[model samples]
Target: MTQTSNRIFDEMARLMNDAAGVAQGVRREFDTLFRAQAEKMLRELEVVSREEFEAVKEMARLAREENEALKARIEALEGKTVAKASKKTKDSEPPTSAPEA
Candidate 1:
């Protein structure tokens, strides 16, 4: 009787172990399927990856900085031009003396 009970318990333990293994395998398969589906959806959405987004963002920043620098240079050149024109006009004008004795 004791031998029969020991055999039954061993069989039950073996079945339990097999069920746990199957459960793990199913979980792994489900994860793979989920990941694939998610990737497909994202691709269809045409979303940009983080790396590509960062690259474009950096490019935009550089363009903005260049634009600002160019604006500053234009302003400086215009100031210099105005200064030169004023100086030239002053030099060309004749000095007038009022009632020279």
Candidate 2:
């Protein structure tokens, strides 16, 4: 009985070692394949990284802000011109004479 038990223990240990080795090999192969694929994709597509994207987004925001400011300034100038034109029309009109008593 003791001899049988020892044999079983030895078999279990060997199986466990085999499983561990296989797992390690699979992990290494997956790592290598994934890195190669990632490199290939990066070379094929001209994709911006997160940091570069953020910087360009910030620049766009600033440009939008400047555009809005310029639009507001143009609107203000237009308003002033309209007001001046109306004032000139009013000033040019002759006053009516009052009725004599």
* Count of clashing residue pairs in every prediction: 0, 0
> Which lDDT value does model 2 have at 7?
100
lDDT of 2 by residue, 1-101 (tens): 99999999999999999999999999999999999999889868987888999999999999999999999999999999999999999899998899999
Give the per-residue Cα lDDT of candidate 2 at 13: 100
Which structure among the candidates has the greatest lDDT?
1
lDDT of 1 by residue, 24-54 (tens): 9999999999999999999999999999999
Taking all chains together, each candidate's TM-score versus the true structure is 0.80, 0.70
Name every residue pair that clashes in candidate 1: none
Over 4 Å off, model 1: 94-101
